[model samples]
Target chain A: EPEVTQTPSHQVTQMGQEVILRCVPISNHLYFYWYRQILGQKVEFLVSFYNNEISEKSEIFDDQFSVERPDGSNFTLKIRSTKLEDSAMYFCASRPPGLATFTGELFFGEGSRLTVL
Target chain B: EDQVTQSPEALRLQEGESSSLNCSYTVSGLRGLFWYRQDPGKGPEFLFTLYSAGEEKEKERLKATLTKKESFLHITAPKPEDSATYLCAVLVAGGGADGLTFGKGTHLIIQP
Candidate 1:
């Protein structure tokens, strides 16, 4: 089965440095998303992207955060300045067409663990 | 706000044992309910999607049922490989753009 793939399985960055996480969603998928899970915590939605634009975002996805589909296959999330609280596992997901509702099933990547110090 | 609450934060079952995990939600308009399994240091793996109340889906030894206010994931004759954290999430009608509102998840351990 085809699956979502993310790069840099793990990353360590300084508190004020920039960090970017990359994902390559399923080739035919139309909707892409970014979510984060703090250690031992529930997964939290960050943002959703479709048609090269942001569909929605959460409070956690403030000005410091940005997402880009620079190419047909790559979806990237960039954080301008990392903070200690930003340490978490960032996951990328994609949804294929055909579901009646926008809330279709999602395929998630293994995730990228970000550690900010 | 959409919220999901999964009950019995943790559970342990002996091989061949059967049990259920519960996920209750409060949302404005229900679009879909989803179940996912997650292993340590990995992303969630989608299991099933319940679109409306009274809908149910099954896979192997696992069965998922949905009602108006809650959903249940039943594991029958479970084995050690069934051990993992089960996450339940809700997608409200107009809340699709924000993605899923996930619960804290239920940690299940099946011992062989």
Candidate 2:
């Protein structure tokens, strides 16, 4: 089965530096999302994208965070200034929403682990 | 406010043992309920989707059952490979963007 794929499985960056995490969602998926999991914590939603614009975002997705579909296949999450609290596993997910059978079924990528120093 | 709560923060089962994990939620207009499995250092893998009360789905030795306010994941004759964190999430209609709120998860360790 086709799955979402992310690059840079692990990243270590200095606090205050900019970082961009990349994801290639399933080719045919129409809705894209980003989530984060702090160590030993529940996964938290970050943002959702569709039709080339941000559909919604959580409070955690504040001024420092942004997402873009720079091209047909790549969905990127950019953090303008990293913080210690930002260190976590970031996941990318996609789904073909609106279809009867596909509703609520999200395919997720392996995730990118970010460590801020 | 919408929330997903899972019980038994951790579990230990011997090979061939059977057990059930619980997930309780309080949300308005539940669109769907989902179950996922997560191994250490990896993202969650989708398992089942339950759309209504009294619905059930199964795969291999795992079964997921849903109701109006809770869901259960039952594992029968579990093996060491069944050791992982089980996560439950709820998609509430008009709750927020992307429609999901997940529990902290239940960590299961099956011993051989």
Instruction: Work out the TM-score per prediction.
Output: 0.96, 0.95
Over B6-111, each residue of candidate 2 has an lDDT whose tens digit, in order, gives: 9999999999999999999999778889999999978788899999999999999999999888999999999999999999998877644464689999999999
Q: Residue pairs in steric clash, candidate 2?
A: none
Please provide, for model 1 over B20-82, each residue's C-alpha lDDT reduced to its tens digit, 9 standing for 90 to 100: 999999999888899999998889998999998999999999999999999999999999999
For every prediction, compared with the true complex, DockQ reads 0.70, 0.65
lDDT for residue B53 in candidate 2, whole number 0-100 = 96
